[model samples]
Target: MKKTLLFNILFYFVIISFLYSAGETSFNFLKISQGARQSGLGEAFTGVADDVNAIYWNPAGLAQLTRQQVCLLHSVWLVDVNYEYLAYAIPVIGVGTFGIYGTFLAGHITITDENPVTGQYIITDDIARASDINITLAYAKKLSEIVGDNSVFSDMYAGLNINITMENIYEDTGNGFGTNLGILYYPRYQNYSFGLMILNAGIASERPTLPFAIKLGFGYRFSFENILSPFTDEGYYKFSENDSALAIDLIYYPIEQTTKANFGAEKYWNLNKFHSVAVRLGYKFGSDLGLLAGLTVGAGYRLTLNENFQFDFDYAFVPYGDLGESHRISITGKMFGPAETNYFENKEEAVKYYKEGYELLYNKKYAEAILKFSESLKRYKNYAQAYMGMGACFLRLGKKETAKKVYELALQNDPNNQKLKEFIESTKWDIK
Candidate 1:
């Protein structure tokens, strides 16, 4: 089935490339970015595509989603044009994730026509309307599920997007079809990802070819906790829960024969478990238009409605040099079903025990700390930090061999942790 799908995608691309080369393309609206979060990031979103907006950035990112999501975006462009986008995504149990999205760009213009016989210009109507609309259906699946536990294909995802587009300009109308192929790779136990996409592989019989392009990108996330231990040697631990991500994308436009590079960074602060605020900044380079069209900034807020529901709002500001500035806003909602249950009955209770364990360990109460860490693990079996605390308790109790074993278990749960690896190696001599 996979082979057949691959063949069909290639065949479609070949046919579309031929048709696109034979026709003159005119629908530039297809190249416009939609989601406010992505637009704020200089459209460098292919690698950080984690929300419903992934339908437009890289559909393969849908594989990372575990719940259903809906997103809406509205933007006011230069010359009074209005652009809007809507997207919804849902996961299908063991199969994969499916998404549907639509983008519309509309504007009003003055129209005039010349009389054939009199050779005189005549105004048929004072106002004329023009619009472009695109609708897409996409699917993404993890290759690990199909290929089994093979290391090479694990954490890899493939996706396909099919789009139908219509353009209307005064008396002229055009229709087209396009496809996007994308892949995303998330290494096991790592907070980074890589992505590649071939976008707008299609042609219109009556219009010019779509804005065909290829994009390659990567993203990395940094997480921080407990940053203020040195400020006050008090027993109280000050923790700042935050995450920051950096993303870069290189895009090649085939028709324009140009390449553009986009860079973006975002920092998120979690006020609590249920709310967060994010600041974003980005820059674009190698734009055919000019160098000044590179700066972008944006912000976002997320609110958790319940264990199963969340809402997100994002805004972006983009300047187009002399043309003007563009502002975009997007709202998204996510719903998690029963299948996506929380790991603990009460996360606060587990965290309390974990923190107590750490405090006991700091006070040199090894036996008591071991019991507290074990209790924490009973509430959250997959807590790697709790395992680390247990290992530390064992080390303080002079059970180096046991400590080495506990640390190794922690490494199993968090395979990509460099600090954990170093700690384990340092304890190797103690194991004997």
Candidate 2:
């Protein structure tokens, strides 16, 4: 029975969509993109979608998320019009990621009525309001998890968004429903991805035609270290630290018979272990709306609260020619599973640093080697190999007291290891 009800709802929605496509359409508010990051990127986010905002840009991107997140955005538009959006996403282990989102666009206007016979005007209400509300539920799944490995579909992801919309303009009210479908492909190579989507494919009550459109997008991201080594220690560069990305999208409005192009770029700089910043710029072309609606600029900051929680804030500035400018602000919170370790807390990363330290020791770079071993211990305090490496580096630098202390700490983490016991015994004679 539930399936039947869902089918009926979809059938009616399609009929409404067809009826609206035959003539004209309404509900232009649905076309406005949400989230400060996306707006700053000229709405070219279909390919770069990777956050809770993906519920509006490209649902398939939700498959890439592994944690729970919530995002809120508020926009100060021209002429006192206000726009607000909120979204949340959660990942289900072995299944997929699910998300819900809502958007509101509203404004107040003066209402007046005239007596036709006397030609006199009477003020009905000074503060009448119009609003558009859209709520959506979305889901995304990675094909590799479902179809097994070594297949053509392994790199593909699919997602769907179902939305219900309500529009209130003074005394008139309209209701509608629609769906968005999207797919993403990540090639075996790193830093490249592609996405395609069909947007707003459904119908409305008062306005039959939905804002049907199609989008194709491409994105690439690479670390600065990939081209030039920034580490002065003559060691292997870290690939995950500093990065930049570029994305482009081609959008088509079938009903309006128009095509548009969007371009976006971003650079991320890590300030410390717990804080980072991003700068973004975007441009749009081939839009008939306004002459100055092309360029956008924005910035974002991220703070890690702990191993399990993080917070982000973003801002965007968009110009609309004679229509003035719009400012968008967004806040996001992310929470990870208790059992899962974050990037900085992973033992594998510590091991990598420990191995690098061993290499520096072989090259007889005592100070640089000590720094590498200390970095490893910062990530994993119980890393026995890193402690031993630190001890060896100190010994090479003729610091017998430091070497003895370090060896004792290593034995504490590996009390049963015979090699550590022998090393600690040998260090004891040096301390004497």
Candidate 3:
């Protein structure tokens, strides 16, 4: 009886936290871990992104990349805390780029009720399940007009993100929506960059509370090898492309009733196409101070039979004192384009499904939209639009399982799609 009472109290707090859009206590875990490659270097991700994971750190960096890539990360922390992150970046044909991201944190806890009368370890009636998940869809576009023809300034890129966030505690569940914006600026002649972004800015619901915060950082790349410099009569000719680059960054963030500043640096060495290594070091300062360090070991190789097909592997390690440590690993298989040109694969397929499903749902064809979205899933199982459509359809159909799964998948792909999460819960309990 006492255990049940204690659990009931804790359950009440969890439910209250969500409904009130409370601080990290209830859904704080939703904060995604830094990219595996970046985190392994000690949470220095804010300044060291080169691939799909760039979406999470600095979307502007996407402008510096020339290929299409996909990455997935999984990690286990102390006390059974589990985390997962995924990203896909596609360089568009003349248009720019887009990235999709998702992150999840889950853990279990037992709530025990102690009887004041019995004064002993008694029955435990409450099992607590905690999870924070979000899905994000982001697009970054280079403004050629804004940054044209400057040898020292290559281009400026802007990105926008839509997110779905959700949480559950025993009998009570709450959901919300959020948004993020990012900008990238790189010099045409340099390997360094400056970035700015705002994350998790918005309200929990219609009232429009919980404003946004900003993060700004500058990074410089340093390289020991004169890989980009040419050997000339003078012994060495220097250029931005000829030398390995070293990078450093300073970042500021306001969140969870606290403000934080971080500084870090990374060094990259190009051993060969089949091997490369980077070392990252950073410091996070806030109400608590912690050191972040990461090491990345990467390898890329071409298949003998198919030059177009290439394989890449990356591993990273990140540790936080009170939060424990995170380890991330990813592998990629991609097919090169014509003459090594940049292009996004399966884009029309993604857009088509989204358009068709949106039309049907808006037209009140919930059932038809469900079918269309499920079909879309068959084509792009990683697409968040289809999952979102499915979730909306399930809401209309009064099917909780479909709604839950669809919302979960949507959140996995976008990690910032809070609307879907809120709708899933409200629809489940018939809450307004």
Candidate 4:
């Protein structure tokens, strides 16, 4: 069934869009970062573009999602202005992923007139109301799936976003359309990501300006407890999402001939399987805003509601020096269930210990790793990999005889595993 959809008409449609014209964009509101997390990172999310917010920073990140997600954000922007943002993402098992997000901002404009005699500006009775709305639809998929050749491009993802925008200033109202192209690459190295995006390249009959720009970004994760390990769970859930990461983005605006950079760091701590907390800090240099104004900080907490649902709350603060201060709040919801139900809950629990053991092994804590592997095996007698891992740990500890015995036991349970046979044959161990 999945293969049949691969050849569907939807797979053949390719949208490649880029615009490099030089001009001022009218819907400047579109340039504001959408989510609190992203904003706290100085909008450097082009690389670390995970979660539903990916729909705005780098749509290609949608390919990395394993389930359905939704997000809502509200920002008290500079100069007494405010905006609301909403985003949703859906991952289709066979057809790729789809996303939608919208940003809305409204404010009243104060009108003033200069008195000729006094040469002083006076507030007038007339005030103008202004508002802006931006909505985007996005799609993303692994390049291998789209091309039907996974051998080479398996780790490459591509995405596109269609932009719909409207701006109202006093009596002049305008509507515009645009496109964004993005790619996210996961190389052979783990926990490293590279991304690029070109966005908002279209024309408006009345506005005539688009915030056409490009972003090149990189992200790296630092992990110690298998947290945010970039590893998936049960082929359905996430197991290693507790970790810290650094992100950088080089942004270029063609119209303004300006280039800026964003640097950010974030850390996540998983209290258990059901709860997590995170903190973030960021700086944007070369922004017209002063150093103090370009600094941002944020924090978040996530609670797993159940097997299939999750919720997160986030807040961010930014000071714009004398201009004003900004405060933002965001809420995110996600739906993803483990592949196994109560019937295999034990097996799922076993995997947790197994991963902990593997990380211990990687960190050269052979004794600790053996204990964890033993705990995993206790949950499921037939888990061949746990037995194998235990054997490896014993070998690292120079207990060759015990290692051999464990390997033999694993082969007994998984008789057809050729890798185990080869592993045993290749090891040089003696049982005197």
The most accurate candidate by lDDT is 2
How do the residues 12-76 of candidate 3 rate in per-residue lDDT, one tens digit apiece?
Answer: 34433432234543344434444554543434444445567777676766655566767777776
2 or 3, greater by TM-score: 2
What TM-score would you give candidate 2 relative to the actual structure? 0.70
lDDT per residue for candidate 2 within 201-261, as digits (tens), equals 9988987667889999998776755544324321221224326778899988888777888
Q: Compared with the true structure, what per-residue lDDT tens digits does model 4 show for residues 50-113? A: 7889999999988888778999999986545668999999988889999999998876645666
Global lDDT of model 2: 0.77
Off by over 4 Å in 4: 1-23, 110-125, 187-189, 224-242, 336-432
Q: List where candidate 2 sits over 4 angstroms from the true fold.
A: 1-23, 115-126, 225-242, 289-291, 338-432
What's the TM-score of each model vs. the native?
0.71, 0.70, 0.61, 0.71
* C-alpha RMSD of each candidate structure in angstroms: 12.2, 11.0, 25.0, 13.2
Alpha-carbon local distance difference test for all models: 0.77, 0.77, 0.57, 0.77
lDDT, candidate 1, 1-432, per-residue tens = 111112222232232233223233556666678688898788888987888788889999888788999999999766567789999999997899999999987776555565666766555446766678899999999898899856698778899899999987666788999999999987643457899999989887687677889999998765444334324311121112227778999998777676878999888888897898999999988653357667899999999878789888999998777656788999989887532221234456668899999999999998889878766765666677888998888777787766777777788879999999997886554443
> Number of clashing residue pairs in every model?
3, 2, 37, 5
